[model samples]
Target: MKATVSWQQALTFSGKTESGFSQTLDGNGETLSPMETVLLAVGACSSIDVVDILKKRRLTIHDCQCELEADRAEEPPRVFTKIHAHYIVSGDNLKEKDVDRAVSLSAEKYCSVMLMLKGNVVITTSYTIVD
Candidate 1:
């Protein structure tokens, strides 16, 4: 739950999580920006929940990928106003209802990052299952 960032010169930084994972972030477009990281966090968080939920239901999930599209406000402090999460799921005997329910549960209950941004961000989710 905790992370640290060190300056890497010229608006760039190296961030390390408590789990020892590290990433390079830069504001000059050389790497992932802070805002882009946030978007990624949201996508990753929800994807984890979706995959886990499906597995727990005894569904054989071969692969899961999420494509996130976001829109930010035009003015300063440009924060995300809308986010669309499109999940492409590949598995055996994956039911549409199950996928829909999994996504709904993640958005409404499981995903912490999505819950945190509930009010400020409009989040929408959809999924396509590949047999």
Candidate 2:
């Protein structure tokens, strides 16, 4: 839960977690900006939930991918105003209801990252199941 951010260079920083993981981020366009990283995290977090839920259902999953689209306010701070997550799940004998439930559970209950932004940001989700 603990982390630190150290300045590396002009608009660049190194972020390290207490668990010994680290990441480099830059405010400039040279790399993934802090905001961009957050956007990515949202998709990753939700995707994890979807994968876990589907696995628990014993569906023979082949792959799962989450595609995210976001909108930001034009004003200063430029925080995310809206986000949409599209999940592409491939498996045998996958039911539409199961996929829908997994996506819904992730967005509505799981996925702490999405839940944290639930009120301030408009979060939406969709999914496609493929064989």
Off by over 4 Å in 1: none
Give the poorly placed runs of model 2, Cα more than 4 Å off: none
Best by lDDT: 1
Extract clashing residue pairs from model 2: none
lDDT of 2 by residue, 1-131 (tens): 79999999999999999999999999888888998888999999999999899999988889999999999999988999999999999999999999999999999999999999989999999988889
Whole-model alpha-carbon lDDT for candidate 1: 0.96
Error of 1 at 41 (Å): 0.9
Model 2: lDDT to the true structure:
0.93
Per candidate, the number of residue pairs that clash is 0, 0
> Whole-model Cα lDDT per candidate?
0.96, 0.93
